[model samples]
Target: MEEFSPRILPLLWRRSVPARRAVGRPPRLSVDIVVTTAIRLADTEGLEAASMARVAAELSVATMSLYTYVPSRPELVDLMVDEVLWARGLTSDGTFRERVLLYAERTFAMYRAHPWLAEVPRARPPVGPGMLAEQEYVLAAVATLGLPVRELNRAAAGITTWVTSAARHEAESALLRRTTGLSSDEWWQQRGELWENWFDVGSHPTMTMIWNAGAFDRGADQQAQDAYEYGLGLLLAGIERSVEGDDRVP
Candidate 1:
């Protein structure tokens, strides 16, 4: 398994100037526009490319105009995240494993929809109604696992962390392919040229086997949900196996 990225809690901050609400004035704007504009910026230019100025430029509004709709970039991010995460969800009307798998698939779908989401830190928990609903639904799905709250929390965190780590890998790999002008499969086909001379026969048999099978075959599927589900099953299976001898899971 690949290692997890250092727990990066990228700071989300509010815009410095607060919206000035004049006495006896109605609300200046709706939250929907602010949320949608922020999401569009992220989807198009990437998360780091999104800022108040960029969002305003996208919306064709003055930068100060957004303050009335959102307090700050962090608040806008919170809202944008909530909007996308709930676009689809899982149900609890199935076996625990089935339900968890469905949830895992749904989680990956959102990340695939907006790749930047996988990079957002969960420093401050999502508090929007949609995000709360997603959390509640996931919690309910794992209820049958019979693990303590902390253990269940850890399991959920592990699954999500794994998803993001994998997504980051695929995203970076895609960028490298574009930059170096070589598909992963092409890179793998020629990788031996770089190290075939140094590879020892006995110690590198495993690598040789993968190379023979085209180890660089990144799935050509538009969505990587199946890959995510496959990994989720292995993780859940390992946990189940570990708990079998213990009296923890009934």
Candidate 2:
């Protein structure tokens, strides 16, 4: 059996080996054109809809020609993710918390704009210029806290992890509602009778008390937004305390 090669790192880093000169007219397509077409396809439809054949059709080129620019679908998706990130660059202009909040807001908005982004598996993220720009922006903001290098890195990672996770969840939820033609609230409401029949107040006393108190009355969108803001506030508070050398932070 042959080992699989991603063949994406070089392309992402713009260090790909030059192709052999073909004995024909210069090719009309470039990597930028290919990636841009794929991104556009993924943005309107879902990521899965942007297959090589579809992209080639959009580009008016042969399907096999796309492979010459982007090795495979996985590589194209990686490129698409990085391109979107690059387009939504972060800013470091503001106070610590404000800057961090702006970063989170921008990231969330990006995910909302391109919901397919949440579907991409980024365990090994593309090391492209866009990814580096985002990392630098966050690290610079966190570095202002005057912590040691290790603590600074950890703080930056924590902020990024929290924001990305929250944004992904929000994006996925939106995509689900769009695809299923039913908002989360509507879906739950449809199951109201089932809940009324199966839910046992005695079994879940705390939940029953909350439900009776109107704690869950908010719409799903509002609830999700509120939860995101609340969690972000807590994260910001913890960072502030850590900077102040609060022993209770641990």
Candidate 3:
């Protein structure tokens, strides 16, 4: 097997070689134009619709011309993610809980605005100014807990993972509803016969008890919001306990 070489980091760090200047006229397309156009396409049509050919078509340029600005689709996506992060610029002010909640809310809002973002894998996130800024904000917020550097790092990572995962779930659910033309409630209602005919109280006594107690009566949107809030409260409480030298935190 061949060793994999990465190209995106150079472009992201602005160390990639400049496009060869054409002898005749100045180039019409720019890196910003290509990236912004790709972002717009992804916003409306999805990540798949932001292909080089499609973006080039939107910009009225030859598909090959896009290479002058972006190396490839993956690089373009990296650029797009960084641009969105840079534009949003998460803040680090307010009380610790307030700051964390605000950051999570803003991140979720970004996913809502650009659902395609939820599709981008961030296991090895792009190391650009935007990503660094987000890291800085997260560290500053987590630092309020006054944990050691190791604990602070772990807390930041854990919080980011939880918040992003929740946001992704929300975005995916919205996309499913849009694509299938059916709200979650409507979908469940369509399957109502299972509850009416096949539901066994003995087999699922807890579920039956909860159903009778109206525990599952809320709208999907409200349920999702409530779940997020509940989880956030628990997370903050845990952090507070850890700060007080709780042995369970480890």
Can you give the lDDT of residue 210 in candidate 2? 88
RMSD of each: 7.2, 3.0, 2.9
For candidate 3, which ten residues in a row score worst on lDDT? 1-10
Q: Estimate each model's TM-score.
A: 0.68, 0.90, 0.89
Q: Write one digit per residue (lDDT tens) for candidate 3, span 121-210.
A: 888778887888778888889898787778887788778888888888888877878679888788888999998899899999999898
Q: Which parts of model 1 are misplaced by more than 4 Å? A: 1-28, 122-127, 148-150, 171-183, 186-192, 197-205, 209-230, 241-250
Error of 2 at 208 (Å): 1.5
Candidates 1 and 2: which is better by TM-score? 2
Q: For residues 27-67, could you state the per-residue lDDT of candidate 2 as single tens digits? A: 89988899988888877888888999999999999899889
- How well does candidate 1 match the true structure in TM-score terms? 0.68
How many clashing pairs in candidate 1?
A: 0
lDDT of each: 0.64, 0.83, 0.83
Task: Order the candidate numbers by TM-score, best to worst.
Answer: 2, 3, 1
What's the C-alpha lDDT at position 194 in model 3? Answer: 98
